[model samples]
Target: MNETNDMAVARAARLDTATLSDALDRLGIVGQCHKIKGRDPEFRMAGRAFTLLCGPASTPPGTVGDFIDDVPPGAVIVIDNGGREDATIWGDILTEIAHRRGIAGTVIDGINRDVHLCRTLGYPVFSKDHWMRTGKDRVQVERTECVVNIGGARVAPGDLMRGDPDGVVVIPRAHEEAVLAAAEEIHAAEEHIREACRGGMRLDEARRQFKYHQLQTRQ
Candidate 1:
């Protein structure tokens, strides 16, 4: 049977961004989003991506896109704002609507505002930083469903996004299976190393037994 999106998300949720990043590194995939972090340390999310691209405002700053309703439930809104720190592309109203809609989460290449609401709603938002300036006149939404960059990572529509307190990782649609399998193997090996250490084995011994040093080495 074909793997459904829900199944993919479920699998992704079982792994953190650290393990996923290692998998990506091992597979020679540049999937790790750099310098992006959760709005709240407790937040975590996983889902397919719904990408958007934004740019500096020309005549007037741009308004938030009316694309929320079209975003499927459990989808992560991936917005690329060119890593601008002066303006925010997301805020309170969007957070409330997204929470109610059951959207998996949002990840921005830049920043966001009104973060208190995000914390209150427990909505997962990963971005470079948060600010008070609005993007209305500072930035504009250029397009939707297009490939965009988040942090330093390329994010395409329908790609899998997994995030946690550590950070976010984007798994390309074509490489999801391989990335996931690699991440699972890495996670299991790490777990075994921990288990051995807890059973009175030396830390270095457990790592050697699991070949942990070579786990993330590119094949």
Candidate 2:
């Protein structure tokens, strides 16, 4: 697809995890939204994807920069750091460069640093925790462009990632169009349910009337 077409597709598909979760009930990929708690309660980022694979006690010097340099302007970086809370995989300096490049936000299955800086820079980052210690000592890149785990979800390079203060969700590239369609439907249904509740319908009655139970029954 051309740049314009790509942008349009991305725009249509981009959504916060809550919307996505409501839609694709079976596809929920869970992770803590630790980095966003004290900051903006709502956050959004749009892009295709560029994934990173890092591990505890593993990244080489310059690895983070090299990976960021290679990522395209409108791609999200999914960093898999094995959920290590001791070291931070991303920091203020990297956030600065990423913003300059117009890169989409980051999703780290690990910890991050410079939380205040990230918030000020308006960069969306989702992580498991926050720490002052850097990754320099405990983490290094074991592989790039390789499959990595984010809360048990197998994320690959080029997959679609949508994250917000709610959480993060990974949309496989092959199923992007289908998943987005589902997410849209899910969001609409949720709105309908919300309206019902506001109209004084009982919670269980509204849920049942809206077929909310079906959301969990998808095979």
Candidate 3:
């Protein structure tokens, strides 16, 4: 992608996960979460193409560095730990390398370590929880190219991932542009409705005036 285009996508993604979730809901997608909470926010990641699906306990010792090295810049790494909250697949070292390599933020379905370090480094990470035990013993990467399950969704490589404080949502490659456009429209319409609501219009009135019911119409 062109640098300018990438920057544009990044800007568009600056909206928080809630807004993105609203967009996804307008486009008919629900049930997305961070998988981790209360950790300091690291919101540096913003992109729209190429997702990384990492399986649990994967990333044996030296391999994580290589994985970070190989992932192209501007790609999101979605780590799937099979919902294992006992071990952490991402930590300080991985976050540092990912930041240096310009890889987009990581989304792990399990746990993470080095929470403070990741915050200090300003790397974005979303996971189920945090634990002190390292993943070396319990976690092992079965495969990098396989479909990894994340919060009930099957995240594959090359899918578009947008995340922020609220949660993360995966966008399949085939529907990227369409989903984005739909999201934009939904955001604009919702903004208008909010303004109307603040201007003394009732919720139902605002909905009717702004065609809010259209959001429920399936595409």
Candidate 4:
């Protein structure tokens, strides 16, 4: 990653999903990935998105996860599998390779298998759920570097993706700076309120002083 993009990702990593979600709401952007969460509560990932789309297996069955080798380091693999849970699009093999390659992490709109391995290797994997069933003949790669729907969020290639224990959020590359600024302001306000409360100020007074109620209101 270039210095500019790397700095952006670092800035985003400092903020959690909730703050970023509020920032998106304040900016009128639908970047929250609903119903998608980390397989392990301790998992967190922040990086540029390397997007891919998946569909039902082909007549003769096509490949699954073969494009992983092409993904660059420090990029989060965002896979949209139509939220299918009957089969898994990820497994131990993918997790091990991703960890070895220094890939940021993986986020799936559907489910994954071998989640235990993910926790063991500390390879973050966020998805709707996990199952042991293989996606070998049930799912196939449809497109790479394409616009894909993750949860209810639209993720295009190279979008900024950040996930914490709560869930994943995508910040569009075009509006990332604005979103980041908004999140930073909100974070600072909240921190100020906390400091005031620690100094014996009433919670309500602190909130009022910081305009906490208006922080997430659309601008």
Report the number of clashing residue pairs per model: 2, 5, 8, 0
Model 2 CA deviation exceeding 4 Å by range: 1-14, 27-40, 56-62, 196-205
The digit string of per-residue lDDT tens for model 1 on 7-34 reads 8789999999999999999999999899
lDDT of 3 by residue, 40-158 (tens): 65454556434444444433433333466767887777777778877678788888888898877887777888988778877787777787898775666656755677777666676
- Candidate with best TM-score: 4
lDDT for 48 (candidate 2): 63
Q: Which pairs, if any, clash in model 1?
A: 61-136, 61-137
* Model 1 C-alpha RMSD to native: 1.5
Give the Cα error of residue 10 in candidate 3, in Å: 3.2
lDDT at residue 41 of model 1 (Cα atoms):
99
For each candidate in turn, the TM-score is 0.96, 0.82, 0.81, 0.99
Query: What lDDT does the true structure give each of the candidates?
Result: 0.92, 0.70, 0.67, 0.96
For model 4, the local distance difference test gives 0.96
Q: lDDT: which candidate is best?
A: 4
Candidate 1 has an lDDT of: 0.92
Segments in model 4 whose C-alpha atoms lie over 4 Å from true places? none
Pull out the clashing pairs in model 4.
Answer: none
Q: 1-219 in candidate 4: lDDT tens per residue?
A: 789899999999999999999999999999999999999999999999999999999999999889989999999999999999999999999999999999999999999999889999999999999989999998999999999999899999999999999999999999999999999999999999999999999999999999999999999
- Say which prediction, candidate 2 or candidate 4, comes out ahead on lDDT: 4
On residues 149-208, what C-alpha lDDT tens digit does candidate 2 reach at each position?
876676777777777666677767666666677767766776789999999988889888
